[model samples]
Target: MSIVLIDSGLGGLTVLHEALQELPHERYLFFADNGNVPYGTKPKETVRSCILSAVQELVTEETKALLIACNTATSIAIADLRRLYSIPVIGMEPAVKPAVELNRNTGKRSLVMATPLALKETKYHDLVNRLGDTEHIDSQPMPGLVTLAEELEFDGPRVQAYLQETIGDRDWQEYGTAVLGCTHFSFFRTAFAKFLPPHIELIDGNRGTVRRLQELIRGREEAPDSAAAAGPVVEFRHSGSDPAYRERMEQALDWYRRDRERAGRPRA
Candidate 1:
């Protein structure tokens, strides 16, 4: 069966990218809600509504399974989405545990750069809890980061400027391992490297998320062969965000198309 991945913004494709790499033989669809970017900051109820709407769209659009690639949305609404719809839903929790395990093996400190909501939401109680707030683990609030992600999506100049403005005055040099708590944050890895030393580590949980999806797919008897033609295509659905935001999102998507074509790479 075709796999469908849904994120509140374009960042979710980072997870989709890794999933495809592991299962290149599998057909897939990736949907990013660029219009509703930044689900982390929104209320739980609002996130639920938007996520439900997206799942409904996919169901009507003929997708078989759904992966909630956005961590914030997953933290808040994954269970409800599963209950409301028959489609299998996969959720994302912080990858701190894996990072911690990696750090202990490598001898490095772990610091998580996630949004405020991610830190505050106890509903995200399902956290792997592998690591603690010990010296190895540092969680901080960088709220407007999704905005920075949107900027990066369109190659906006504010990207570098925004990073410098946010991190220049701070001391991020202390941590060796940095967990990109949000999916969108994965796209800004290059810019983040500019601010961090080369030895610093950047860890993301997209791969783990994909593994869960694989397990779900395997359990489904009706699931289609991943080798079938990849007909599951995804698009942005801006329910009620700013018009300017929608325009910028469309432009960024166009850029993705052009770049993918030039590189002879399939859109992830």
Candidate 2:
């Protein structure tokens, strides 16, 4: 049994990276629906169907829990997933609540960078509305970052050009924090930190999501047995099932590891 992390592409590796750091003893199954990659641009029903189909293919009696690591997929299909599955179903959302709290009384807004489909979702809007800080929440659709991440372009002249083109003109002084709403965007945190004003802090939901998974797993009635205790191992799979793509997944993980090391961020 393993905690399953699903995404449209390699973005969920960000979540898995965090999980491995925090819950090092647990096994993980990372499923990337790369055959139907980029769910952020698709229609709501289409994204939902793809997510449901992929989840159906991945979930099993041995599956411990499911984490929809893609913000776009979570916005579109988390409800259906929760209803259909008995295991704990965790979903991603922009860390708007914490961003809002952090900016409270700071006279600064939070800039949320996500994909078009995710930003357009009612779930995203409802979250901002529920927080009652709609005026202070700004959203920018970053569909390109997902493509760049899938291509393994984390940082370079091309990445810098893209980031600059997207946000170069903005007045960073008006924002207290920038939220990496999409998991793919987390890959470029280093780039974002360097480009944005030093005053603006970067935030994401990856750590929070992993913490939720820990709480749920610990709350479970069953005790850890041999199967559960066997691993900090990760089994990677994708809808495409291409050996090349699997290699890319491994490469992405390695990239993330190196990125963290370069940033001097603690792994555990």
- Report, for every candidate in turn, its global Cα lDDT versus the true structure: 0.67, 0.89
lDDT of 2 at 133: 80
Q: With candidate 2 superimposed using the best TM-score fit, by how many Å does residue 230's alpha carbon deviate from the native?
A: 7.2
lDDT of 1 by residue, 85-199 (tens): 7767788777787677766765577777777667767744335343453656767666666776676543345667766665566555655677888877776666666667777
Local error of candidate 1 at 163, Å?
2.6
How well is each residue in 152-186 modelled by candidate 2, as lDDT tens digits? 99988889999889988998889998899999988
TM-score of 2: 0.95
What's the distance in Å from true for residue 265, model 2?
3.8
Model 1 scores worst on lDDT over the 10 consecutive residues at 259-268
Output the number of the TM-score-best candidate. 2
> Which segments of model 2 are wrong by more than 4 Å?
221-231, 266-268
Clashing residue pairs, backbone N/CA/C < 3 A, model 2? none
